[model samples]
Target: MAPVRIAVVGLGKIARDQHLPAIAANPAFTLVATVSREGDGVPGVPHFQSLDQLLERGPAIDAAALCTPPQVRHELAAMALARGTHLFLEKPPGATLAEVAALQGMAQASGATLFASWHSRFAAGVAPARSWLAGRRIDRVQITWREDVRVWHPGQAWIWEPGGLGVFDPGINALSIATHILPQRFFLKSAVLEFPANRAAPIAADMHFCDTHGAPIHMDLDWRQTGPQTWDIVVETDAGRLTLSNGGAVLALPDRTERDEDREYAGLYAHFAALIRSGQCDVDVTPLQLVADAFLCGRRREVEAFED
Candidate 1:
């Protein structure tokens, strides 16, 4: 079978760090081109100032991966699907649930695979952690995803924008993993958002959620932490404690034994390749739905200004 020809839209930090490397490593995908405004063209591949130009001039690419911000994902996704190409979208599929649903409809009608890739759900230890929790009763869960954005994101301007998602960007990853590992479907109970005084979006958020069966999950997200970085999710159950650290890369059981390394992006692309080959679609919006519910119900509080 021929490798799927892939073109990536939005050549930002994630596209550089995760998507490109994953595509390069995957035997089923070929990096054919990229769409970027500044045009840091990928070597031996074409670069376009926008998706419009890429679609107009590039070779026959089978799939288009959107690494752009959530706000604009809908239009790009719709365009690709209409052009008879499969799509791979970054997390937080679209700015609004309505848009994602619309894209799903269009994809089905067009017979194109629409994959909303939540990379964190593909973490190295996620599979094992999920299996461990399957038979046990989950009691409580706590998630903390705090990092110094200046160190990790640097001068990324879109992060603080209205539709850029701010701190929830990382927080959503935790939600995705939590949703995947938990046996029961959950709903939001309450939330509080801490918006930067001078910014349009929140810099921190604290959310509380519960399952229909009454399992409580608490989430804390901050972009201002400066010390040793922390990205962890701990679940305490009737059996024992299951801690997934380094953003689900390391899974440590209660007995102090740890397992595996990170393979988030690689796993996502592998899934994407398989979906495209098998004529299937994978779009899980539970995490993004939680985010939307929080935004809809939470009261906003203005906090200290953040500048990169």
Candidate 2:
């Protein structure tokens, strides 16, 4: 079978760091072209500055991975589906749940695959954690995600913008993994978003969540930690305590013995390849829904100003 001819839209930080390298290493995909504002050059692939230009030169491309911001991805996804190309959307599929639902409909109508990928769900220890947690009764959960924006984001200014998602950017990965490994789905019960006084989005958020059964889940997201960054999730269950740290890179039991995993992007590409081969679409919007709900129902509080 011919490899899935793929194009990547929004050649930004993610596309450069994770998607490009993964595609290059995977035998199931061929990186054909890219769409970005720069429109400069990328090795052997044709590059277009806009999605329209790339779509005009489409058809040879079997699918397009949208690495754009959540706010603008909906329109690009719709266009890709309308043109009969499959889509792979980066995390937090869209800025709104309605948009993702609409894209699902478009994909169905066109008989195309729409893969809303949450890379963290594919972490090496996730499957094991899920299996271990299934038979146990989860009592409570806590997540702490703090990072330095300067070191991680550099000059990326959109992250602090209204649609850019700020600290929830990394925070949502925790939500995704929780949604996958936990036995029940959850809804946000209450949330406090800390927006920099001068910015449109929250720089930090403390959220309270509960499942239909009332199991408690608490999340703390911060972008101001200067040293010893932390990404950890602790779940207390009937069987034992399960903790995944390092942004899902490491898993530990109560005794603290650790197990490591491959990078998440690699697993994500593997899942995409399997989906394409099986003629199926994998679309999950639970994580994105939590984000939209946070925006709709969250109490916004003004905090310190953020620079860049």
Candidate 3:
């Protein structure tokens, strides 16, 4: 099969650090063009100031990866899907569930592959953890995902905007893994979101959830951590304790441990290529749904203003 000609939209930090390298390494994909409103793009590849310009005048592409902020993803994704271009959406697929659903419908109508990618789910330990817990009786689950936003997001002002999702941006990664690994479906019970006095989005959240079989699930998410970052999940089951740390890159079972190099984005690109070839769409909104529930029932608390 020929390599899929692909364009990468949004020349942001993630696009530069993860997506570009993944595309370059995957023999199944060939870089064709790029789009960014700030006049940023790859050196040799065709660069467009907007997706409209890319579609109108840039090189033809079979697929596009949307790496822009969540607030503006819907319009960009819709344009590509309408043109029968396969799409790869970064985490927090859209600002809202309704928009993502609409895109899924568009993909179906156009016969284009729509992948709402959860990169964290592709972490090496995630698959193993899911397999190990499949048959065991889940007793309880705990998730702690804390990191310094200044380090990760830097001066990305869009993150604090209304549709940006604030800390849930990273928190949802944990949910993606949990939703995929757990044996039963889970729903949010209650939540408390802490908003910095000056920002439109919350800086931290404490949420409680429960699975169908009554297994209690607790989540603590914060963007204020300054020291070593933590992205860890601990689950207790009939067999024993299971731990997935380092953002699902390391797994610790009762008797053994497993760890591997990072390959989340690589795995995502591979899956996207497969979907495009098979004429299929992989749009799982479970993780995004969980984030929506957190905002719906969550009590809001105003805290000290955060300065970036």
Candidate 4:
């Protein structure tokens, strides 16, 4: 079968660092064009200032990976789905749950595959972790995801805006893995969101959740850590403790520990290709729903202003 002709909309850090490379490595996809408001694109592919320009004058594409910020994703996704172009949405899907749901409806009407891609759920250890926890009794879960925003998201002012998820942008990745691995469904109990004095979004958050079985789950997310970063989830089960570190790249169980190379993006693209070939849509909104709930029920606290 011929490779799926794909375009990448958004040439940001993630597009360059993960998306492009993954598409290149996957023989099932061919990069036909790229779109971004600023900065150069792939050396040889056609580049556009906006999705409108691409759709108007660029080569035909079978699919597009929307790497743009969540705030503006719904429009681009709707445009692509309208043209029957398969869509690969980066994490958080959209700024609002309703918009994403609307996009899903559009995809269904257009018969286009819409994949709300969650890279973290594709991490090497995530599948194994999910398999291990399927039959085990979950006692509790603790997630600590801390990183230096200055180091990771330098000069990204949009992240502090109303539609930008801020700390929850990264926190949602953890939730994606948690929701996938944990057997029972979970719901938020209470949350405390710490916003920087000068920013519209929170820089840190502490959340408490409970699974259907009454197991406690705690999450601590902060974007202010300076030194070595931390992304870990510890789950206490009846059999033993299960731990996933390095954002689900490493897993430790009672018998042994497993670590694997970073292949999250590659896995995502592979799944996208399969979905396109099979004529299906995968738009799980559980993680996004959890974040929305956190914002809805969270208590607000102001912290020192952050500058970057």
**Tens digits of per-residue lDDT for model 3, 1-308:** 99999999999999999999999999999999999888657888888999999899888999999999999999999999999999999988999999999999999999999999999999999999999999799999999999999999999899999889999999999999999999999999999999999999999999999999999999999999999999999999999999999999999999999999999999999999999889999999999899988888999999999999
Worst 10 residues of 4 by lDDT: 37-46
- Residues 194-251, candidate 4, lDDT per residue (tens digit)? 9999999999999999999999999999998989999999999999999999999999
Please tell me which model should have the higher lDDT, number 1 or number 3.
3
Assess every candidate by TM-score: 0.97, 0.95, 0.99, 0.99
Candidate 3: stretches off by over 4 Å: none
Per-residue error (Å), model 2, residue 119: 0.8
Superior by TM-score: candidate 2 or candidate 4: 4
In order, candidate lDDTs are 0.88, 0.86, 0.95, 0.95
Candidate with better lDDT, 2 vs 4? 4
Q: List the residue pairs that clash in candidate 3.
A: none
Model 1 error, position 305 (Å): 1.5
Model 1 ranges with Cα > 4 A deviation: none
